[model samples]
Target: MKRLMFYCQHILGIGHLIRSTEIVRGLTNDFQVCFINGGEIVKGFEIPDKIELVNLPAIKTDTEFRELQVPTGFQTIDEVLEYRRDQLLTAFNRIQPDVLMIELFPFGRRRFSAELLPLLDRAKAHGTKIVCSLRDIVVTKQDQVRHEEKVCKLINRYFDLLLIHGDPAFIPLEASFSRTQDLNCNVHYTGYVVQQGVGIREQKIGNGKQAASTHLPTPLILTSVGGGRFGHDLLKCVAEASKVLETKIPHHIQLFTGPFAPDEVFEQLQTIAQHRHNLTVDRYTPNLLAYMQQADLSISMAGYNTTMNVLTTGVRSMLLPFTGNDDQEQTIRSQRLEQLGVVTLIRPSDLHPEAFADRIIECLQTSPTSMQFDLGGVKKTANLIRAIVHKQPVIV
Candidate 1:
């Protein structure tokens, strides 16, 4: 098998890492994969056993994207960046991969151009095929025209193919990015990449239609905030909402306040849950799909990975898109999904305990309409790479 080196960085949230890993997992059978992760590792996040995962000196940013933070051992951002740059170059030289796959480079994560531009130059010199693994929606910048121009230049010069992990019928890349005509690389839509084994599991109950079970069992409410760094308000509101609904509804609420949640926030949630018998708080879980599969109502942010999971499990969901920093990726996706009748949109004004609790009750009573999405991104990604390696044409 040809060796493929994959680079992924998660600055504030784990959505990017999770999506990239799912894609990497699907490529293991076809390629000898070397995964390079450039962010702090979450404790329980599973790394695929079949691939070589290189964890560089971790660096992250604040939720506002203002400052770069280095871990305890590092003194400054410069130190961490220098070490990471050296480590990445070393790994690429050692792996000598036939393909170098990078996630969200030109489209986002522009801060890492210090290291990535060098890596791209090295790959170009070595005659390696470069690929950009991108999500459906990209974050819009203030200087939109300049940003598009830079992205097109970088992509045309370095990347041989651009694999968009979305369905065109749902929302094409052009919705956010208008410079597709300017990019010279081969671009293809691989549908939406979902976690493996999405629908194979047996469904225990209907998809969020039945109310609090009047029988011997209680209903389940599942909530998660991706990475937990920026979702404290959402989780806290859900915790308080659980208290408000405790008397009116017979249900158990399980909150996964992601792995990166601050210690104080986690402790606060624990304290809140201590008095509420119907609520529980945890840091992280490797099996979120299992929870979604069993949940009658799934409440969380409208991130890429979580939304895909909700859609695949056919679970009733309330999506509160992260609106910080004027980021509209999640909002755009959530609005479209809501329009499709698969999810309920939670606005910023609905964060109050009483209001949120009422919304939960309303969502639980209504079933999400079953809709078809192209969930075949994994297989198609692998096939596309294989065809590219073999110099064959694939109908995109």
Candidate 2:
């Protein structure tokens, strides 16, 4: 059997792990997949029984720069680098996999490049097929040429394949990466990777029937803003919006404050939600799909992985995208889908309590239906990985 090594590091939220889990689930049958994760986000995933996991020293990011903090109490950058280097070298020597897949390297996770460069060198020396997986977006054109030049160097030197988890027809790669066609032979568009679970058939909602009605409400409105590290504005906006719409539109609001939120904020939300018969506030829920299934509408930020999950469930959604750190990517994506009549985009600046409530009400009024794309990409990605392992040509 072909052996594959998958590497991913998630700092802000569990989006990277979520996407990686989809890929691992798809490849489990034909490959002996090993996962190397080094962050708090790793604990969030329900990894498959067949896959083996190796936990590395966890690292956290600072607000100013992508500084690495060792979980076992390291004070200096050199100490962290030396420790990670030793760990990676040992892991690579032991695994000796046929392929090595690095998630978000050469584009997003540049901080980890200190350890990754040496690992990539070792993989290349050992004849491992090196792959770099990217989500649909990267940093904006803040320093356009400089960013492109750096990425171009990495693409030319290290990666054998650039696996993009998006359809270019919807949002082209060139929109983010300059001179993308220069690396054409190595690039592959492997559609969106969505979350999966038992008894969850593709495109089927609420087990193919409406959920049982209760005294509380029928059509629920589920809302989340990733890990709640940066959702204070969003949560406040939603809370105020719910108050405005209480009398006009009767629906229960399930607000997920995310895991990283402050205890005080969560407590306050809980208290506010307690008085409102139509509102419920809680921390993260692992079974988000269950709520999405029963939800008449979803109000959420247009994070890359979150949007994909929302689209997969075919729920009428209103997206509130973050304005900083090249988050315009989400805005672009949500707008494109909005043109397709799949979702509605609500910019952060334009968001108010009343406006948000109005948008939610509008989405709830629409009929839920199937999206246009064939979501067989998970299986397709599995097949492609298998073929690559066996030295067979992939037809794009």
Candidate maximizing TM-score: 1
- Candidate 1: global Cα-lDDT? 0.88
Q: How far does residue 269 in candidate 1 sit from its true spot (Å)?
A: 1.2
lDDT of 1 by residue, 255-322 (tens): 88899899999999989888887887878877787778778999999999999999899999999999
**TM-score of each model, paired residue for residue:** 0.94, 0.89
The number of clashing residue pairs in each candidate reads 0, 0
**lDDT for each residue of candidate 2 in 1-396, tens digit (9 for 90 to 100):** 889999988877667777887888788888899998866753244788999988777776643333555666787766776788788889889989888999988887777788889999999899998888788776565777887778788878877888888777767777778678766336777877777743322221121223344222457788888766676777878877878888988677888888777789888887777667677786776666656766788888788767877877888887877665545677778887887888877776757888778877877888754566635557767767766767788854
Off by over 4 Å in 2: 42-44, 63-72, 197-217, 368-371
Instruction: Give, for candidate 2, the lowest lDDT window spanning 10 residues.
Output: 200-209
Query: What are the clashing pairs of model 1?
Result: none
